[model samples]
Target chain A: MIDKRVGDPAQAVADVKDGDTVLIGGFGEAGSPIELIHALIDQGARDLVVASNNTGNGQVGLAALIAAGRVRKMICSYPRSSNSRVFPELYRKGQIELELVPQGTLAERIRAGGAGVPAFFTPSSVGTVLAEGKEVREFEGRPYVMERWLRADFALVKAELGDRLGNLTYNKTARNFGPIMCMAARTAIVQVSRIVEPGGIDPEVVVTPGVFVKRIVEVANAAHESVLVAQGVTYP
Target chain B: MTAELIHAGLTRDEMARRAARDIPDGAYVNLGIGIPELVAAHIPPGREVIYHTENGVMGFGPPPPEGEEDPELINAGKKPITLLPGASFFHHADSFAMIRGGHIDFCILGAMQVARNGDLANWSTGAPGAIPAVGGAMDLVAGAGRIVVITEHCAKDGSPKLVDACTYPLTGRGVVARVFTDLAVVDVTSEGFVLREIAPGVDLDTVRRLTGAPLLAAAGIKTIEP
Candidate 1:
C-alpha cells in the first residue's frame, strides 16, 4: 500500500543510508526525480551504489551525487557525455567504480527484478563482450546469454501525475525507466507534479500502480526549467 | 519521356556511401543498427559529424581494432566502440538529453515501415516470431531535428515497407523527414511523399509498381549517383 502524505524531498531522501543501493529513474533528463536528487545532495548521502538506465546530467541528476563525492559505484548501460570530464577523471583516479550493461539487457534485468524473476536468457549480447564472464546456455538450437536480476534498496522515480494511492503516469520520454525501477527496488519513492485523490486516475493510464510504489510526494512542476532550456532547440 | 530509374540493386557499402552524402558537415547524428551502421564507415574524410550513441558516448569514432575493445566503452547494442579525440563520456541521462533535448541534428535510423504522413514504425514488425523491443527509436524519432530512415524498399515477404500508413506500432507519429532506401531517396513533406531521387538503373514505373502508396514526383527528381 502507498503512503500518501505531504513531505519534503530532502527529508524523505534522508531515509537513504550510506552504502545503500539506489535505483534512479530517468532516460537522461526526461523523468529524473530532481527534487529527491536535490534532497539527497543536500543531505550529503555517501558511498552509494546507484543503478539506473544512465547517469543523470552533471549539474542536475545523479551526476550531482558524483559531483558531491557521494556515489561510490554506478551500474548503468550508458555513462558518458553529461559528466564526461568528471567521470573519466574519477575513474582514472580510482574515485568511483563503474559497470556497463547492454541497454536492452539492462532494462530487462531491472524488469526481471521487479517481476520477481531471478534470471532470464537473452540473445542480445550473445557472442559479444557483453556476454563475457556471464553464464551462457544454448536454448532451442541458439545460444542465449544469462543476465542476473538487479534489485535496489531504494527506487527513485518521477511522474507527471499521481494519486494518493501512488498510481503514476509519466509524460513522453519520462516513461523510460520509471515503471521498471518501481518494481525493481525494495522501497519506491516517487516525486510527482500533481497528486490527486485515490481513484481519480483511470486504471489504463496508471503505468505504475500503487502496489509497486511505496511513497508519493507532490511537487509543482518537475520539468519547468528543463523545458525552458529545451524550447527552440531542434533535434535530428 | 524515357523511363525514370527507381531503386537499383547495390552493395551495402554503396548504399552507405549514398546515405552519407546527404549528411551535412558538423551535424550531430545517431546511426541506427544494421545497414545504417555502415554509414559511419563511409563518412567522408575530414568532415566532422558527432555520433551520439544511446549507451552514452558522444564524438564516438568507428569500431575499435581487434583486441583493443574496452569493456567500459560500448554502444547501445553493447558492442564495443572507440572514442575519438576530444570525445566526452557522461551519464546515460546526458546522452539522452542530447537526443530528447534536440541537441542532435539528425537521426539516421533503420525502419520497418515509413508512412506517407511520415509516421515511423521501425521497432516492431508485429510478426509472431520477431522480438519486440522499442529501444530508443521513439525518443530518437520524436526528438531529432531531422529523421532519416534507411531500409530496404520492401520486406522479405515482398510487402512494401513504405506505405500510405503504417500497420505496425508507431515509433513516432509523423516524424520522418526523409527516407534513404536501396532504391531511391524519398522526402516526407507536407505536400505528400515525394520521390526525389531514384536508384541508378531502376525505372520510375518499377518503383511505382513496388510501392503500395501514392508516389509524388518532386519537381527535380533525378537518379542518385554513387
Candidate 2:
C-alpha cells in the first residue's frame, strides 16, 4: 500500500535532522509552506542550509526560522526585499553565510539536479562577478560558465491539492519551485490545502507524480505570509 | 512639465511612452522593475505584446482591482496581478528556459550605468557594506534577443549615466542595444553613442555636456514630443 499521509505538520517534519540541506519552495511569499516551517522550528533542527528565492519578509516564516538561529547559511539569488529585516542584520554581523546565484542559473541547477544531470553550462553569468571562479568554455565562439546541480536532504513545499499517494497540484503562481524541489530532494514534505483519495485527482492534471513526494499533511486553511506580516505576527 | 523636468528633459511617463512606440506588435516582452514596468501601461493600442515574469507566468494582465489581490496570483515583483484569458503558468525551470533559450523577443530594463560599448552595471556598486541582491538581471540581459534600457539621463548627483566605461561591476558585457533616457534616444553601435532623437526644448550641446562619451548626431534626427 503506498500511503504517504501524515497526521500533522509536526509529524510531517519530525525526521528533519541537524546539518541537513533544505530546499524551501517559494518565490517571496507565494508558495511558502508556513505551517511546515513552524513545525520544523518546533522540531528543533539546527545548523541548516536553506535554499530559496528570497529570505522571508518581516519576522514570520523563513525570517522567524532564521531569527530563532536555526539556519547557518542561505543559497539564493536575492536576499533583500522591502520588509526583509532579519537576514541583513545577521548577514552583516557575520552570523550567517550567503552564496548568491543568478536567478535563472539557480533554477536550472535545481532542474538539473532532479533530472539526474551532474552539471550544465549557461551564459547567464558569463562575464559577471558571479562567473569569476567558474570554468568557462566556448561553443561556436560564445562563452558559457559551468554550474553544478543542487540537491538537498529535504524539501518543504505548499500545494493546492494532493492525494494520499502523494500526487500534488499547486495554485497559480504559487506553484513556483514546488515541483522541482520535490524532485531535487530526498524526502519532500508537502502541506496541502486539501487531500483526496487516490483516484480523486485525475492523472492528467497531476503536476507532481507521487514518485517524488515522500510525505503529505493536510493544512486545510494555510495562512498567507503577507497577511501575517501585516498583522505583526511572529512565530515562536 | 514640472520645473525640474523642464530643465532636465522628458518626464518619466513620457520616456516610457516614447520607448513603448518602438516595440513591434506580437512580441513577447519582459519588463524590469522601475521605469521599464511603466512601459506596460503605455504600450501602443494596436500592439499585442505578451508579458513574461521570471517567477512563472505568461500573458499576465494589469494589477487586479484593489482588495481583490490574490497572493498566489502575482508577478515576478510579488505584486498582485490578473491573468489574461490565455495566461499560462509553469515551473521555474521552464520559465527561465523561455528566457535563456532565446524565446523572448525583447527585454527592457532599468539601468544604473551603461557604457559606450553597451556593458551594463545595474546590479551592484561593489560597496563594502552593501547587501547585494541580484534577482534575474543578468539572465535577462544575456539571453533576451534585443535589450533596451530606460533610465534617467543622469545619476542623482548630476553625474552622467551613459559613460565611456562603467566603473561599477558589470551585469553583462556588450549586451545593451538601445537606451531611452530623459534627454535623448541613443543607440549603442560600433561607432559609439549615436543620437536618434532629442527631447523637445533640449539642445544638442546640453546632451553633449551631459553625456560621458563622444556623441554623434544621426543623419535624420528628430525632436521627441511627449
Query: Per-model C-alpha lDDT, please?
Result: 0.74, 0.93
- The alpha-carbon interface RMSD of model 2 comes to 0.7
The parts of candidate 1 lying over 4 Å away from their true place are A223-236, B1-226
Q: In candidate 2, what are the lDDT values of residues B20-105, reduced to their tens digit?
A: 99889999999998889899999989899999999999999999999999999988888899998899999999999999999999
**Model 2's CAPRI class?**
high
Query: Relative to the unseen true structure, what is the C-alpha lDDT of residue A108 in candidate 2, on a scale of 0 to 100?
Result: 90
- Chain A TM-score of prediction number 2: 0.99
- Which candidate tops lDDT? 2
Kindly report which residue pairs in candidate 2 clash with one another: none
Per-residue C-alpha lDDT of model 1 across residues B125-226, encoded as one tens digit per residue: 557533234456665764678889888888766788889989986766678888887778888988768899988887778777777798888888788877
List model 2 lDDT by residue over A55-156, tens digit each. 999888899999999999999999999999999999999999999999999889988988899999999988889999999999999999999999999999
Candidate 1: Cα lDDT at A6 = 50
